[model samples]
Target: MTSDAQVLAAIINALGAPKKIPSHPPKYRRAAVAIIIRIRPDHGRSSAHSSKRRHRQQPQPQAQPRQQTSLSKQPPHAEQPSCLDEIVHPESLDEFFAQTWVQSGVFEILFIERANKRAGDHRWTGHVALPGGKQASPDEDDQETAARETAEEIGLDLADPALFRCVGQLDDRELWTSFGRDFLMVLAPFVYLQLTPKSPPLKPQPDQVASVHWQPLSLFLDRLAHPQWTPMVINLSNKLAPRISRTILRPLFGTMALHSIEMPYKPEFILRYQQELVKDTDMHEKAHPCSFSHSHPPYPPAKTRTVAMIDHYPDWDPGHRPLRLWGLTLQMVADLLELKDGPIQPDIRHKVWDSHRMRKRLDAGHLPGFSQADMHFWVRALLKFHSWQQTEKNKPSESNRVGSWESYYRMVKQAFVFVVLGRATAIAVLVRMLRAPMFRMIQSSVPSVRHSKLLK
Candidate 1:
């Protein structure tokens, strides 16, 4: 059994060596998200109290007066300390985790449920995601974008040296449409660790974040705690394709099957909107034109109204839905987990051709949220497509002309349809040719006079 400290060490080590992607053309957009990690006291642990007591017992150091240097004496272009420099060193991290109080704590990661869509933009609305947004002009770099977005969305400032430190970052990922046609943006994930024993109170911006949650990292690593993937069906009719294209392709592709992970633990909401937190049972009746009653809500009813009222709710639920990890956010989590646990096998390149073998490999490895059959196809397609992209990217002249994985997947889909239709047509022609000879033989078996009369 691995300790939480060991797991975190492995993650930090992985983040130290990130697979970075080069900046894309001006046409392509970029975004960044922060994966914030913190160790909180367990249900019965007194770590926070103990830490407070220890702080109170320690003697305070007297403040020293600052000596201002002359402007001429100071060196020009002196480099300032970065957030990365403030990160906990390996030796310090080990010492911190070695403490009894810190060892008893639970490792947790922060997540946020996005607010409802305004009008035209509906992407990631009400989705459980890491705190982040697109890159802005003021941001110094990609990592800065992550820190800025995190601070803007949730009031936990990653840049605050006293509270948090930049652990490192994960590999950059390119987002694509469901149909694999258009490229969306590149997503860069940065990891941060809380230096303090206790987490700071978070103030979620109501417009951006509907609620905030702290999910245990153990839930993602344990197979029994987090069950296998559940099917999330997508309607093809609601896609952005043209009506004529949809009509022609409806028979071949009317619906798409995706997978979602049902979070086992009930999320602890740090900050939530008032309307989402409460259930107004009498508000509907009071608002009705025919009703003229003014009733006061019961205390117990208000107390019992919580997010956990619905048991095992589906992902497609309209309002007050449970936290279901899926889509891009889930993929990011899996990527981090993969770093800690290592790959499923020494090499999965040969196994991509065999779906069953690959699925078995993923299952044996106990990879959370990736055991479904639907996911297997996608996993294989992406592996092959990425391999191809890498080959193309390496070529000198073709590197500039290389397309995204989406375009490659679309081409493969079109080819598959043509292959299926071509085979069907060939089989039909062969069957007709074979039946013609049998018909002639039956005609010969009939008497000459009867055959002639039938023909006439």
Candidate 2:
């Protein structure tokens, strides 16, 4: 079996993020350290990579492997999977939340999640039991610091430094420092190896790890995604009702166009969460040219892209305005992020997209468009959108809460906070100014009575 450590070292080299090099003759950035415990299940004698076994308890004939048959080739012993055999999941780890999760210069994509948890009080909880880095004396390199810290934290041998991984680094940032300026520090990416029965000799040291043990990454993810998780998802369809209704949707009234779409659900869509938002056959049955049908998006053995959001909205055509926005957003975001060239520049916002020297990368295939560095920047902008404090205040709705009967008979909700915080002045004025609603309303009515929806 190939040493996981060696695999990790190769990965670090390919990532090329300077912070990961611990023996830094000239250190580039701050980083955190972690340990990737390889917990091999009892039946499967631990080996990180998959390779054929020459011998096993079950009777089998061993044939020399000239080359394993793949789609492009056929070998003498190529056989279909047995129908009676139980399906075993292939091992793998998923990229974290960042768009370039796998590609994050600061991150080291490591082990797969544990297949199943064992019953116990659960000190391991769900963590894979990674560790953090602490600087040793200035004399020590970051890699040295990592080895020292890991040994101190988990009682492992640093002399065999090759057991640890040196994944790249990410620039860490924190807000509201005691002195007022941002408090910035990086958590280096180095992982420790947890040997069996001993569990890496975790005898906690003071000023080292506050606590230690293994836990699945999923457990932490569960806590973060829980509704009670702090900074809960603030539902805005109500809070920003006035701004959404008055400003954004106002100008869009007449211009809002719809054509039932039928697009392919490629593997990328599956990775992005579109697989779960499966439309009913009826919807797919009637999909227009632009929309995806149910099946051409053959699920690939490996996945690449993912869907961002799938939610409903009221302001635009109730059929699915948000999907339309998401569709359009995906189209432009890839271009705007410069992952793809938008020279022909499809869609309305083409003029708004700024092209820089970075555009040259489009010609080069460091990626089809943006480099991994570009992806990090894109992620940063999204974070800004989440943390931005500006308001989107707006005009009041003329309709009085959908009438007493509907309010009494059905659930009614509105986003007062979002509306108050969005922008100044309700969006109704803009709608009135643009005369958009009236124009759209008139499309279904005689042109002479175009402004009639406003009367209602």
TM-score of each: 0.60, 0.29
State the lDDT of candidate 2 residue by residue for 41-143, as single tens digits.
2222222111133134347657756565344576544433211111122122221111111111122222211111343535333222234454645625555
Candidate 1, which segments miss by more than 4 Å at Cα? 43-91, 224-227, 236-244, 264-321, 342-456
* Model 2 CA deviation exceeding 4 Å by range: 1-14, 17-31, 44-52, 55-130, 133-136, 162-181, 192-199, 206-211, 216-456
Specify the highest-TM-score model's number.
Answer: 1
How many clashes does the backbone of model 2 have? Answer: 49
Q: How close is candidate 2 to the true structure, as a TM-score?
A: 0.29
Reference-based lDDT, each prediction: 0.60, 0.30
